[model samples]
Target: MQTLHYLTLSVLIPPLLSFFAEPGALFFEGGATNVGMIMDWREMAGRPTVRGMQGEDRWNAYYGAWSGGKQLGSGWVEGMWDGRTDPMRGWVIAFSWMFASFADIYYLCILVRRPRLLLDFALTLGFSHIVLTTYYSASIPTSLFFWIVMFTWSATTVTIAEQICVKREMTEGLVISPPRDEVDDLEMGELLRRD
Candidate 1:
């Protein structure tokens, strides 16, 4: 659990600080770099019109998805992100991660045994980005935030699984062999034995 907590926080806290307190907006004012930011986002939404996409009225024809549930050019977008694209959008995305991280901190304090709660928190955080996106009027930052929460939650779940497996195995005093590629696993065995 200490390992999980440490790993979770490594990716968690900095983004939280950036989220609450705009990081480096001092220099990204509407300028060339900022223009690049706008271009980057448009290009992603612009792929449907590419030359090779001929006969493709919609990109959905390739993804096996219908246009109805598809979220197209309209949705919740954080108004705050538009004005300050570089640092602003960056900051909003960072804020989402920060919220996830802070939630992890809460999980550590309250749900150490009920790991399902940790998994739920991460998944909720990931999906929350979408809700927040809609609430913010459909924006790219929401997508980015979703990615952050997904990653954190996945990592937490993995750590929890490993810990549960290790505990179950240790009760029998069984010597489980480490994978061949995992040199670190040998050291982990020694460390776990000491515990």
Candidate 2:
């Protein structure tokens, strides 16, 4: 049931958002701005503030090079630094994602009971969000790394979800079992004999 709820929330919510919000704007660009805490006055302002205006100009020039537009050339680093310093508003967005990820991990821990798989999924998902929220502050290489982590997290999470959903035996109560290795039994016997 927890697994089902997690899947329902994770799988359903994003597509629902896509119906209302502009696609890729929130995903690729710094458009999830309103999704988290509104720390800046500009963010709350109905109209664009100075930083928003400046950030948009900076964003265009930075994204311009990749889009085959004129490059920032020597001014690239300075432009990046300027964008990184503006406001810590991005952290609020990141924190919201982080909290959601944490809740998912907690539910998974109870649902799966498989430590290794759960750990891998949780860590990958956690790091992906961390990288994701840092988009405002990240450079080109770091942004590329974030994409890589996002892909890895997606693949790992899908696999784990599939395993949980398909296995009917794991759908209920604590699925505990003792270690099943003969080597461990032998080691235990040897220790008992020594004592």
Please report the candidate that would top lDDT against the real structure.
1
Q: List the RMSD of every prediction in angstroms.
A: 16.2, 15.3
lDDT of 1 at 172: 54
Q: Model 2 off-target regions past 4 Å?
A: 1-86, 126-195
lDDT of 1 by residue, 64-133 (tens): 2113354222211443222222334444334434454554555543444444455555556445544544
Residue 77, model 2: Cα distance from true site in angstroms? 22
Which candidate achieves the best TM-score against the true structure?
1
| lDDT scores in order | 0.41, 0.41
Give lDDT tens digits, candidate 2, residues 71-143.
3232235433222222233233233333344456446656765745665656655454445434533322233
Compute the lDDT of residue 44 as modeled in candidate 2: 17
Work out the TM-score per prediction. 0.32, 0.29
